[model samples]
Target: MQQIDIDNHHLNFQLELQYARARQRQRRRNIILIVFAIMSIFYVFIQPNQYGNKQNQIQYSQTNGTNGAINITETNSTLLQIQKHFEILEKLLISQFQGKWTDTQLTSNELAEANFYKTSYQNRFQIQLHLKLIEGQFLEDYYNQFSFYLNSSQLVLPLEDNNFVFENVRGSYRRSSVYENDQSSLEIFANLTMRLNNINMDSDTQDDIGIELDVRYTLDSETFSFNCNLNIINIDSKAIIYSTIVSVLGVIQFISCLKLMKDFINENRMASQFSLIIFVFLMIYDGYLGIVHFFLALQSEYFLTPAFLELVLFFFLELKLAKHIWQERFINLQDNLNLRRELYRFHLKFYLLAIVVVLLLYYLIYYNVFLIAMNLYLLPQIIHVAYKGQYVEFDKIFVFGLLSTRLFIPIYYRGCPYNILHAQVSYLTVTIIILLFAAQVVLYYYQCKIGPRFFLPKWLRPKSHEYFIEQPIDGECAICISQLTEMPTESQLDNKFIAKIISQNQNKLMETPCGHHFHSICLTKWMNVKLNCPTCRSVLPPLI
Candidate 1:
């Protein structure tokens, strides 16, 4: 019987070892499957949505030389290319028009004047210039002088045809003159004006806009160069008024973002602080674009690099912020650890894809999809808040407000025409948000200064004496079983004074209706978990 029992025990031990090994193998297989699943999802989603060939490709080629020749070739949107062609056409027409003005001048005189009839349809402009160029710096000096002139220049278009206008036109000029390489080139830069539309006018057009252009013919080369950086600006008076309002609102929004960032920092919310910092940067970039749009002559393309950087930064911030919200709200969900690990992997892939998108697609509108995706990721948190009927975090409120500013208001202006309704809706939304923010600030201050009782209405305020007592029945608290009269010897106050406060004001003692007393802090902590008196197990109202 003993030998049979030993053999049975050996069999049982071998079976148990086999079962343990099988379980370990199963766990490893599950881990492998999870990793494979995460990678597969990443490849499927992230790989397919790469920037396609539809974007404008900018390439640079340099030849081997001391003064390397740089060539830029692009396969871009035909529409944009056509737009550039039209701009070149307008420039050619303007140059021809100015040549017409030059023809009427005396070619022999060092100083001559050309006067043209002011066609009723078009503006009659005079060209005059005083030129002095130093030796060995003809090209650069002439370009610099002309660039300065274009900065102050403005285009006035006829009411009928407003296309092909350049305002705040400024840039370096490309010179193809015989005098370009000369020791000195005395060239006077001149402005050109022409009537592009209604060349065949009925009964002679009336209003006239005049320009004065001065040019000096150089001896080294009998040629000159003229060009302006073309950026369209067609803001009407109504649009200007609306833009002013939008600017004011943008300032307010920036202020609000900064305040929230400060709060996040103070509260030690690192993730939130990082997100708000990005928001502040984005607002500042928008402000810069706004200035370039409405007040400056710089081309929108000039700001593309910074704008692209901002877009990439924004996507990164959104990813981080989404992950932060998810972890905070989804801690109770099953498989949370695996979900968080996968989330990091997904976000890493997304960050790479976002950089690619911003580089390939310069349009800011493309990034709107990212914002939508971020919000979708946060939908669970939104739903949870809705179910609980609680206030959202202030960061969320600020984010939505900023998004509205971008989506509803034409904050960048960009010369796109907008109706009065756009202005009205933007103004209303921003005003309401500002008011709400102000109220929240006030409430937060009130909460900090006053106690928790102030959170409830006067009628709902619980009578403290019913649950609190001036003295403990025993020397120790019934809940913690610690001496209630124990005081810290912090050298700032007398022990007697501390004892007097505890005795007279029921300082640290709280008594339940069941006639048992506990430390106020201990009882409150206990009630938070189980809304009942610890000593008697009696039901009580939940702590607010």
Candidate 2:
């Protein structure tokens, strides 16, 4: 094809086009920022503030004249609230966790002495219990001689970061073991599990974080002790394996997405389907995983690297891949306004459905049901292939990566009893889960092979479209023939023929499915407005 004669075309047209596009992009960015700001304001105002009490923390600054701290009462008030909450927590824990834990039994002689002391003088009863508590794996805090800590769990200090925060609730209870030692006290241990809901494999109910504390206190001093020696159910060694798998998977995905993007960029004719449905699902998937990893990075021993990598991967995957596809495939399609809107709606609707509905159902329902929800992300891609009735080449690593990425959790959760994340599954449950995911993969395979409408009724099938793109042809464009064949301008002549050699060649051509050829540029413009052969009026097909 002949080169486009830059001299004949007004430079202003190119500059104006560039300027218009820049304006459009700027307008879009502004709208996005505005919407984001509004949403952020709404979230800030509407959402309950977890750090409200923290924000109310009292600051002591000296007054110039008096050389005394101002508003000392504010500091007192906060401290009082915290202390009250701690007292309440101590009481509640003591009630649930008695002094003589089932695991630690007193000798017959000791029990007799304790009972006798309780009958004679109730005050000595608590002192004996505190001694026993200390003997039974509880240790006095090195810094504070009066306070003690459980060997099993770390001390839960209010200032330290933790998953759950203890807050003040009204109406405290002073009930205790009725023994004495009012001067003694025990306090919060941080790395404690309250066992919100008993997680049983057979049970359909989900797990929750509950406050299961064993507290004991006298009238003067509240004593709170964690169940240390009883059962230290720390998360398993399998977590390291899980984190390792995640790291590997994240790296693979990162490389895969980068390679696919590179390939697509090199092959400028990007006429294959890039399913927004799958793309958005992946973004959501990565987003949630990234968030989970973020927390893990802070807390877990093995998760830091994977968590950081996953977060980086998600941003990279979404920002680069989504932007490229959006810019090249959607934004560049100048004439397909309705199709663009429809695709946008499709993308948005699925986004809402995936996040709100799928997540809600997954949480509300049984994991067995929701486990399949993870695998169902591919259904939209299937729909796209079906609607188009054309087998578009999809990224194999990406398709399989979805499967591999989801595999580790289900397998470890269901199969390994030692797994900290989830449970021991029945063979049937495992089979069902594997089959559900495998079914999606298999169905996708068939969709690619036998066409997406293999299972559909013949009447519902989309009409076959042959674009003759398999064999792109060559010739001059009829629609733009006058412009192409017009007399060469002085500027055009001056630019190319300076070497005194004829350099202009025929224009690049494209072919219709009906075997008619036209300039590639001209046909692209013509097809945008009218999907028909220019000479024979044969129907044209949609381009990806």
**Winner by lDDT:** 2
State every prediction's TM-score relative to the real structure.
0.30, 0.46
| Candidate 2 wrongly placed segments (more than 4 Å) | 1-236, 268-271, 327-332, 335-362, 393-395, 422-427, 464-544
What lDDT is reached at residue 175 by model 2?
Answer: 16
Residue pairs with backbone atoms closer than 3 Å in model 1 (clashes): 120-205, 125-211, 126-212, 126-213, 127-213, 127-214, 128-213, 128-214, 129-214
**Global lDDT for candidate 1?**
0.37
**Which regions of candidate 1 deviate over 4 angstroms?**
1-194, 197-299, 305-309, 312-315, 325-440, 447-506, 509-542
| Superposed Cα deviation of residue 292, candidate 2 (Å) | 1.8
Most TM-score-accurate candidate:
2
lDDT (tens digit, per residue) of candidate 2 on 19-66? 998689668756755664464445434644322244443321122122
The digit string of per-residue lDDT tens for model 1 on 153-226 reads 23323212423333322222323222344233233323333234323222222122223343332224454432
